[model samples]
Target: MTTTSARRAPSGSVSGRARDFRLYWVAGGVNLLGSQASGLVLPLVALAVSGSPAAAGLVGGLGLTGRLVTAPVAGVLADRLPRKAMMVTALLVAAAAMTVVAGVLAAGAATFGVLAGAAFVQGVAQAGYESAGAGAIRRVLPADDQRALARLEARNHAMQIAGPMIGGSLYQLARWAPFLADVVSYVVAAACVAAIRTDLSPQRAERPSFLADLRTGLRFVWTHPFLRFVTFWAAGVNFVFGALIYHTILVTGRRGDLPVSIGLILAIASVGGLVGALAAPKVLQRVRPVVAIPVASWVTVGLVAALPVARQPWSYGLLFGLVFLLTPMVAIVFQARAITVTPDHLQGRVATVIGTTGEALRVLAPVLAGVLVARYAPGVAALIFALLLAVLAAYATANVRKLRATVPAVEED
Candidate 1:
């Protein structure tokens, strides 16, 4: 059996790499778009269907929980199966789940329970699909191309800028329309993945029970000092980001003066991410990852903490601009670091672990943020998030020296 780390081909062939990236470019891009569309629409749907903000928070938490459950196993599956097949299957399953959502909506019988159940199934499939996608990229591309692929990953962030706005506009036309569109996007992604011809080299592992394999993934992260610190940093920052995201919605909806729509918020956030993604490679090329991580983290914390204090709409706009300016840079650097530290064969499992942790934090943030909103004040959670981020920023900087020493083995395009 072949493994991604063990396989090597001559580098710097444009035609060959282009052919491989086409599958990721098309399928992955569409998936990102569909996901963005669904992400924005789902919360709105939850709000409408359930008529309770707490229930909406539960929907997000439950979805994240499902992703957490699948992440460990998805890594094993990515290593075991053909990557292309796994990605296609995952997309197909997600599409089917969306179709179920559409049917429930069309029947005018949708409930919060139904949405939660559907989101759980869809979230599991999404984790599997992403694991396979990450593993496939590790198999197909050379090292330099992988870095460039990080830019493409940034495109997903860019979509975040546009997708919510688009979904929100579509929602105005009809409540069921966004889900219908999401289903179609998934179908297209499935077809695009099927069109790709590259093979995913499967590694032979001793057949372990699923629980055992999961333990292996967890233990690997625990024993590795760099992985441990990086995961901790990612988890902490993600929790802050998740809290900010929910609060952004709260600010827009709860504030009487500023009637910023969901679309505008998504656009603003995405714009920030796009700026970061575009600048990531350039920044990494200049500054060490260790230096960049703390810088970006502090900038984000500073901006978010100030957001709630901004009494006027213009103040929110100023804070929003600053957020888009710096946070995306942090995200790209962190992601590139994650990709570089792990061996190619473990990319899927590693990504799964990373993603699951982030999602789990997202789940926790909403529940906690909701409590803050319910008890103390509207934007109190954002203030606490800022303080927590400040502590984590210091932690990341302290560990930066250790992480910077682990230079990736360079391969060419």
Candidate 2:
């Protein structure tokens, strides 16, 4: 393994500068599709086996617990190990787990324990794969290539929209089909990653204790004001949106609206996300963070605030579309800024610090929304989440100026 600096990348499209990035992107896209499809289908598999909603939820939670526990540890490993090996190993482990599920299903011997175990193992492997891949991509691509990052955002949204549709269709055909599809996706992704020409090795010279390495990751994020603020902001945003989407679907279903109408509303919101992700590069490129960051924050605030008023299906779709439409644009701009400023050695740690916090907080979003919907009118719940977004919006407006002054080297592409 050899060491190279992320800062050494030449100025160009990431694909042009890092010839291996095309492979990286393909690998990422395949993995995203597999993960999304499996995530939705796994709960259904559990439901089929156990015939209990609680059992299904527990199975899903176990998977999330696996990821949450492994995520921080994986970040340290990503910085200490050869990233390519880590990535390939992670994919193989996950694929093997899915193989077990597929085999059991085919044998007509699928059980709760086996499927649950496989899901948890898959999640653990996924965490490691993501932690390593983030550092690897950052290492390969030019630090300033915001367009490439935006492309990743677009890929995620596009695949996410397609994954569940594909998964549902496949599951109707055969219970084991989605799991097998995931296995094939993993094999393909692993092959793509293995083909990358970049040197995907750790740059650090000294090894630290596990606890010490974990502390370093947290310390780096805590010391960086922009990163610290954005971490909390992201968590809040995730929480609000998660609740908003969940409740919209739930309440719509309860009202006996045609499934197609409800699906259309959600589908429109997803389309907005896809469009936002696609446009994020251009939006990020043209806008200066000083001006862009604050304006976008307020725009989200306004859109969320309007959700309570969108009662009809068409209106819901339009308003939710507008809300999500701006979300990826703002988020990608923030991601571009963070990725550019993070050092090569600390990339994995910094990413985990922020990502883990956001996921942890987001777990509570549905609980809060459930309670709110049961007790109050939908508009009141919307107002509460809107207030949360407003606080972050104000924080962003106040902090962007200082971050600009302090981190002078990072700028919009």
Best by TM-score: 2
lDDT minimum window of 10 residues, candidate 2: 404-413
lDDT per residue, candidate 1, 260-300, as tens digits? 65445555666666766677678778887777777877887
Give TM-scores for every candidate, taking all chains together and pairing residue i with residue i.
0.84, 0.93
RMSD of each: 4.4, 3.8
Off by over 4 Å in 2: 1-18, 142-144, 402-413
Leading candidate by lDDT: 2
Instruction: Report the Cα lDDT for residue 133, model 1.
Output: 86
Summarize candidate 2's per-residue lDDT along 214-309 as a digit string, tens digits: 787687677778788889878878878888888887778777888788778877888888888788777766787678778878988888888878
True-structure Cα RMSD, model 2: 3.8
Which residue pairs collide in model 1, if any?
Answer: 12-413, 272-324
TM-score, cand. 1: 0.84
lDDT of 2: 0.80
